[model samples]
Target: MKFISVTTADGLKIIINLTKKIWPVAYGKILTMAQLDYMIDKFYNETALLELIDKGHVFYLAQDDNNNYVGFVSYELNSEPNKTKIHKIYVLPETQGTGLGRQFFELVKEKAIENHQKAIFLNVNKYNNAIHFYTKLGFTKVKDEVIDIGNGYVMDDYVMEVDILQ
Candidate 1:
């Protein structure tokens, strides 16, 4: 698989398309349909994503050997002074167990080290099962948070972290 840096409108569009395919499956179980759709529109729109990039979010698209864009991840260096923040990450449901997810994390890990960050972190929904995938990657729950994302919804998540400088 190849990781492509997303730096243009075309690339952002690709990430938006992938989110439409991956979000429903990734969040369906723990989130109501209304909440799911709301969150998608709120965060995945081209305007919002571009704003994130302007604020230092770096996005990468993972393309398979056959040239399919199977997944994507975005991170921010120095989000916590000496740590990087994973803003988003998702792989197609069929690609879940094929090591693509770990590859995404490793992609972030390598960049974090190069940026002199000591660790990387992300927020995962508390009821989401991907917490297990994260646990297996050495991330420990650092804290829990309830973020009000408007529209009568709140994200109850665990702030998970893994050291990268070790």
Candidate 2:
């Protein structure tokens, strides 16, 4: 697998497509249809993605040997010193058990280390199955948060963190 830095408009568009493909499957059981629709529009819209990139978020697209886009992750330096916050990570449903998620996470860790980050953190919906996956990858739940993301939608998530130096 290869990780491509998403810096161009075309690359951002590809991430958008990947989001559309992955989000429904990943969140369908855990979130209501209305919530899914709202969150997708709020977070995955092209304009929003461009704004995030402009705000210094780095995105990487994961491609397989056949050049198929299997997953993607985005992260940025957080307000906390020496820490990075993963804003997003998603893999194709079919690729979920094939170790692609781990590969993607390793890439994220490499990027964080390159940026001199001492720790990496992410938020996972409390009811999402990915929580177990993150735990298996050595992330520990630090705190629970219920973020009011507008439109009557709230994200009930666990703030998971992992010390990269370990």
Candidate 3:
């Protein structure tokens, strides 16, 4: 697999398209379809994604050997004073168990260390199965949060973190 830095109009479009494909499968059971559509429009729109970039988020798209996009991740360095925040990470459902997600995470780990960050953190839906995956990557739950993303949707999530070893 290959990773591409997402900074152009086309790159943002790929992220949007991938999110559309990944979200239903990833969140279908956990959230109502209305909530799912709302969240996607709220966060995955070009304007919202651009704002995240303006705020220092870095986005990466993972591509397979055949040059198809399989996943994407975005993180911000020093998001909390020596910590990196993983703002978004998602892979195509077909690629879920193929280590693509882990590779995306490892890339963040690498970048955080290079930036002298001590730890990386992300928010996962409390009921999302990915919590187990994060645990496998050495993250432990640090706190719980409920974020109101508007339109009567609230992201009830657990904040998880893993310290980077020097």
* Highest-TM-score candidate: 3
Candidate 1 per-residue C-alpha lDDT over 1-166 given as tens digits, one digit per residue, 9 for 90 to 100: 9999998889999999999999899888889999999998898888998999899999999999999999999999999899999989899999899999999999899888887899999999999888999999999999999999998999999999998756
Q: Which stretches of candidate 2 lie over 4 Å from their true place?
A: none
Per-residue C-alpha lDDT of model 2 across residues 21-99, encoded as one tens digit per residue: 9988999999998999899888887788889999989999999999999889988886378888889989998888999
Model 3 lDDT per residue over 1-166, tens place: 9999998778999999999999999999999999999999988989989989998999999999999999999999999999999999999999899999899999999999999999999999999999999999999999999998887789999999999998
lDDT of each: 0.93, 0.89, 0.95
RMSD of 1: 0.8
Per-candidate RMSD, Å = 0.8, 1.3, 0.6
Q: lDDT winner among the candidates? A: 3
Number of the candidate with higher TM-score, 1 or 2: 1
Q: Which ten residues in a row have the lowest lDDT in candidate 3?
A: 147-156
Predicted structure 3, TM vs. truth: 0.98
RMSD of 3: 0.6
